[model samples]
Target: MSALQALRTVSGKLQKTQIQVSTGLRVATASDNAAYWSIATTMRSDRRAISAANDALGVGAAKVDTAYAAMSSVVEVLSDFKAKLVAAREKGIDLDKIQNELDQLKSQVLSISQSASFNGQNWLNTDVEDIYDPDNNKSSVVGGFTRNADGTVVVNSIDYSMLQSALFNSTGGGMLQADPRDLKTIGGLRFDYGNGLMSTYSLRNTGGWGPTDFNFDFSSPITFGAGDSISFDVTADQDNPADGITPPYDAGQTTSIVIDAARVNSALGRTDGTIGTYKEYAAVLRSALVGSGLTATTYTRFEPPGQTQTWVDVPDVVGIVHNGLASKDGSSMAISNVSFNGVTQANQIAPRAVAYGTRNSEMTLDFEPFTVYADVVVSMRLRVDGSYSNLSFDKDFADLALGKDNGKVETSAEMATLLTALVNRPDVIAQASGSGTVSLKTDPLVDRKSGEKSMIGIDGISVNIEPVPTMNFLDVDVARNPEMIDGYINYIETAMGRVVSGAAALGSLQSRIELQSNFAKHAMDMIDKGVGRLVDADMEEASARLNALQTQQQLALQGLQIANSQPQPLLSLFQ
Candidate 1:
């Protein structure tokens, strides 16, 4: 090659090396190496974006931590409230003071919810209107990065909603809120026995009887003269004289209604019959009277000779006033009204006698709008020797129709007594349906604005009441009645469970947030390392390259000087 051409080539190589040493990069701009610079720039941008996303994740984690902390405080407060409730159940303890303490603890929960906020995001204290919105309630945090072929970048994130659960929610499942109560029927009717004696007997007890079971307490005993006989008959007889009187009488039993005067006179005069005279006839007749499942009693009143003596002949009466039933088999006869076959006995006034359930024979009667059951009760008492029998009883109300004022009792005494008798009555059957009012139960912690049951959520932790109270817990009078303390204790225990569950929920959420936070940090470090591999300068390689380039520059300068000297020698030859 010629001297000038060679010199130009070496000078170009020297300029390139000098630039590389000064810049410390092989591809500083697109012009340097378009493909390499482009790759490095894009990769650098990705790293920055990833770092920014990680920063956002950090902020979100802070907010979650704050919520979790608030929930922990709420758990403490609820625990204290439960303790106070337990204390309130103690005898002679002041409930009002205990309630005051509970109220304070409740207030603490509210305060925690209100203050549980981060970066102006208050999840705990949010209202129903705000949290009900799907978009508003849901929170998203930066999670990961993705690049598409379309040159678009995507940032993935995690999302979750802050709301109350079964244990704690502000709207329906929270510690401070009440649960809804369903409509229900009232329980069994209780008898108001006058002397504080209450009993509920099932009409199914065919063998059982009440205090006064259709007894004929005669004022005076009848004296049977010659050719005189009394007939005893039962309207619906199941059996004749049998080996034993079987109750719930089956079919095919013989019944009789005849009276023999000759037999009666013969028995009155016989010593075997225990009746030598007419005065002792009634007592002997009771035993001699024969009928299936038939029972009798005869007693004499203290009176002078020649004066008629009193006697009592009736069915056996037994059983408590208000027992539910003899058996739960659900088959029992209902008594509506009683019929008397003869003159009334002692205290056998029409209204009072029916009210006291001392009537002779009862039967099943139908009635409308019955307060107890559909079928009315019918009972009876027989006075064979009396001149005549008169019956007076309101079939529909029976004994319940005493001192009626608009079909209701007017006098308290009569009302109480009548109610007592009705409660004590044996033949009155207990039916599932009746003309009774239904009681709608409700909880005490209902929302003030809507009066609907709602729960309260604090810091993502929820506590709630379940199997909602039939009555307001605050209104429960456990202090007055010692028997009610057990219920109150149960309520407190349930509340404690709610609080504990809430705390556990918060703990789980906190762990998730922590793991995500850690992942975000790790991802940032990995991204930084990747970007460094693409664009960051290698100082060791750059330093070595700089020294080599400097030596090449010196050699190029010396070569150019030598080429100029050769041109000078050529000029000498021309001289």
Candidate 2:
């Protein structure tokens, strides 16, 4: 080639390399412009992140929707329960029959509670926390229930203090602590299957006690049912006699105690807790306390009414600290002002004060009735309070709580916290849906475990019966007066209505949440877009440059060829 041609070729090569290096790219600006490539890169990265965020939000929303759908079913079941109650009231037959219906309805409620868990988390089952508030003397108990996969559920809330007074208050009502003496000395305890397990606790000390080893002459776990019935006489003991449940003190002076199975297991997919069928049986508790004209320590003394009679007559009903909390005597009985059937006579209690003594053996318990309409008010869990004034009756409350629900956390927060306690604590389990499983479309909702609801309640559910059977559960015989199960249904109806009303409020809040969530997502998207715009590549610009670069390369080659022709002329001259 000619020297001039070679020089041009070398110069062109140098220019190309310099362009490539300066642009930090082999191809930039059609040939050396690298701006488009950089733009494209930035856009793609930003888009990917946005896509990921969208996916996450989408999944979350879908799960929430699923829960909502499930809750719809729960609502339906509750409606049925209410319908049944109305029908029963109209049928009006035997009070016993009505009781039976309530019993059945309660079972359904339990069934739903056990079965209503989403992804394994049970909203009805609430969790407990140790709240150490630095400010005022404030203790807290908060929790909730949610939907499940197969059936409805009764969420177990974990609010101890509130629950205690509610459950066992002869005076101040709320949740209540059971009588430890009752645990050690049960009036009627009959278990069929016998692993030969009989627990007994004593509280003779001045404070909380344990494993007092109360004697049990029970003839094994009597597997006998109706027809093959066995009549066994119940008494204090051969050794202690009617020692009056030794001082309500500590170890040497303990007052209460509790005992029950460590766990609850069922072949059915039910997460049964300590209080079995609380809906049906809650009346038994209420009847034992309230229905029986027994005033418990549920309500505070100076709060409202009748803190004297019920409290003093039954020093402790359902294991509550009735009468006065400690030393204060709120009873007007000291003035010989006690009466029965309008007979103001001196009723003397043995070895103690005389107040409604004659009515001791056979007490007259009032009946508000055990009512559970097809609805529910709330689902919650119970927690034990460590701060026991005494342990004389600790075992009773613990035993009842554990034996019934199997310690799955009580479904009523105020009731559980207000009552159950051993040391001064909140030994409550947290209820959440199975980490990833979806329930009635609700994130934190409650339904019956068996899909069955009460006659008057709204938030109850039960999946106890298998095969997802028909919703036709319990029957009611409504011929008798005072409706044997009136209180339960009534309470449920009242409670549920409130719950539903409250839920409506929550729904409003939920709408707000949705709005906020959307806003957050939009804001996040905008931020991401801005970031991407800053760094993402513009593909269209890049593509255009690539095409232009190809054309330029071709032109450069042609120019070089022409430049080489000059060298050829030089060569010819040389020739």
Candidate 3:
């Protein structure tokens, strides 16, 4: 019975070993080893999931590679475009040909953007109305899959923004189509007046027309005899209606000055009351004007005939030149109602109205290269020659000014033209130069030299636009505006830098995906090894066990047979 039981145990052991060797798993079912079987099953499932995740990473990596390639191509094309623009800057070059080359380069960029797609995904070209829409303009790629300690599975993605990566879009929001510079900080219009003529009136040098002082020249010199007196009403700050004028004009103070022999002698420090030359007459007139509480000055020196500089002392040939105070609060000054008694050539003392200075009224619209949006509105009130004109700039205004319906100002020159049209005044000349600087000046024809009324003031200058890039690469025209070549180059360089950054970003994503893929593969191997330790049979151990069990089975079977054969010896068995 013992031998029979031993044989049965060996047979069971041999069968188990054979099964282990065949299936390569010791704990193939819950009955073999419940704990190990459960753990190994779970681990095997996890390994399969990791393998799937690694495959997903490959697809993500391919997408990144496609985007990176396109970005690199874009960078190269932008470099060539910039070079073309620089070449166009040369003074006698055929800018039209260079522009044609630039157009071809742009077209190539468009082609690359449109064709840089993988699995119907194109990151470079978009058609959204607003790339700034965060939810709409964002793209993502599956980056990784993870299982938490609590047994929850999760998938993660690598996200990228198309705002900077997009090379072209239907809306003007692409890197190349959008303006790249912020011009919202540009200064408002400024008024500038040229420097006026200066004159001195006394030997004591106590009276002289300083810079910005308003002055009028006499047609010829005048000799004043005893009892000679000249008088005139001088108006200062004429634009100020508060002083005396009406609406559209500010008030200004009007005062009178009389020059006589006594005043001349007094100014000359002589008690004798003797008549004096025009120089002495001017000195006394300046003193009298000062006593009358008026801002006044006189000219003792005059510009020599046929000479620009080196003004000699006022000679008998020169007339008495009188000057008024500088304009106050942007007001003008004028002298009128003149009368001369006992003075020769008094008619030659022709006093013309003059602004405080020869400075022309100018307002500079300083604009940096910046993107102008469709909704942007530049509005301001311009005061020209005491009349106010409201000026507003927008897409509609630009379209009308350009005689086109396109809601875009194609160039800085076009912007200047639009502004000029907005002002719509022959006296106010608007000119654009060097990228986006717009200078609006009172026409030289209306300047003090031309003796025409000239004044410019800007108020409420504002634009309903944020500080953002708005320049479009396709709109660049170096042939028509060679001066803007530098601006074009700057914009292209900026776009290229962005493209390079995007490429680097894609490269980084590719590296991450590769690392994750490698990690997934390694994890799979580790999981297989761990599950093997839990449920995989060791071939060397299983083989040795099988041999030992088989040998024991044979020995037990012989022992059993021997016991069965010796059963006839009843006496020996009983003993």
Candidate 4:
């Protein structure tokens, strides 16, 4: 019975060794080793999940690669487009041909963006109505898989903003189609009296004019008919007790000048008694001043329209003229005691006494750096020597005058240059110094006695602010609007920067995905090794055990047979 029991134990041991060798697991079921079996099973499932995540990472990497390729192409195309725009700025180039090339480049950009897709996923081209929609304008790619200590499994992904990568969208918010820099008004006009007092006037409304001696409404043409005349008294070298200079009270000379058709015709060297144009009328008035003993070099200087070199030809300067004449020889002048015959009030040519040389009318503008996003419009109406000159600075004017890529005055020096170009008048001098302060004044007149320099006034100035319209790279038509080439170049340069940035983002994502894929593969291997340690059987050990158990089984069987024979003999003896 002992031999039989030993034979049964050896048989069971051999069967277990055979199962271990066949299945290659030390704990194949819960009955073998419940703790090890459970742990190994869980590890094997985690390895499978990691393998699946690695596969997903491959797909995500491919999508990122496609987007990167497309973005790189777009960057190249935009560079070429900007080069063409720069070439178009040349004086005699054929803008139409350049525009055709630009069109082709723009079309290529669209083609690349639309065609760059992987598995129906496109990052450069989008169709959402608003690209700024937070929820819809983002994309994610599977990056990694994680199993927490608490036994919870989670899948991780890499996220990217579609807004940054989108080059073309059916809606209007694409990077290439939107405005990069915001329109901003940097500086405005203000009266600086060289004293501590300064004042700013509204640009939109004309009611801000402070105390004035005379207000003339020349908004329309004046018809000087026969026998019509206007007269005003002019005084020179007037003595004042408040002038701070020793004075013997020398009586200044006063003269009256009559402006009529007879005088105008006499000034024009014609007997027709008629002035054909407004320019001719202005010339007649200037000549009358010179003929009335006021020196042409000192008193006849007047401000012209900002757009022209002379005051007589511009219509916009005809409204609400202001006077700012000064003497160059320390002699004061005044116009007063006005009388008009046959001149209606509709002409608004009323005259009043004004003490010249008492105050300076020059203005200074302090400009801040342009850092906002909006269009800026500066409207100014300056009065010099009793005349009006209207000037406005907008994108159109800036482009025409400066021909800069951004079409904006970014610095005080740039503003001065733009103003100088826009005014185009020799008498008006605009200068920038000490950071961003722009001093606008007429050419200085030297005082013959005291050697004091006197600058005529630049008054009635205002500024207007407005937003610049969005300029799209695709809509660049230099052939039709040749003036907009600067703006086009600016927009294209900004768009190219955005495309390059998006491409860089994609490249970074590609590298991350590759790293994650490698990590997933390594993690899977490590998990396999761990599970193998828990449940995988050593083949050599299992085979050796099987052989040993078989040998023991044979020995026990033989011993059991011998014992049985002996038992039979003992039983016979007992009978």
Each prediction's TM-score versus the true structure: 0.47, 0.32, 0.54, 0.54
Give the least accurate 10-residue stretch of model 2, judged by summed lDDT: 449-458
Model 3 residue 456 distance off true place after TM-score fit, in angstroms: 18
User: Which residue pairs come into collision in candidate 4?
Assistant: 182-373, 182-374, 183-373, 183-374, 183-375, 184-374, 218-318, 323-386
Give me candidate 1's TM-score against the actual structure: 0.47
For residues 239-296, write the lDDT of model 1, one tens digit per residue.
Answer: 2112122344333222233223445446455423222333343334344444322333
Instruction: Give the winner by TM-score: 1 or 2.
Output: 1
Error of model 2, residue 456, in angstroms: 43
Candidate 2: tens digits of C-alpha lDDT, residues 462-544: 11111111111232234443443353244345434433543343344345446545654665566566644543445555455
Error of 4 at 246 (Å): 43
In order, the Cα lDDT scores of the candidates are: 0.43, 0.30, 0.65, 0.65
| Model 1: lDDT to the true structure | 0.43
lDDT of 2 at 181: 14
Candidate 3 structure quality by residue, lDDT tens digits, 1-575: 99999999999989999999999888989999999998888888888877887887788788888888989988888888888888887778898899899889988988999998888888888776667667778888776667799988887776777765787877756777754323333322422211101010111001112124444444454444666777777665444322222345434567776776667667888766654454554565567766222444444444667666676654443222223334443244556788878775443344556444233366555553333445667777877654688888776676778787645554556667776788888777878764766676665434332112335666666565432335676777788777767766766776677678778877887788888888888889998889888888889999999999989999999999999988778868778
Error of 1 at 215 (Å): 18
Better of 1 and 4 by lDDT: 4
Q: After superposition, how far is residue 143 of candidate 2 from its true place, in Å?
A: 19
Question: So what's the TM-score on candidate 4?
Answer: 0.54
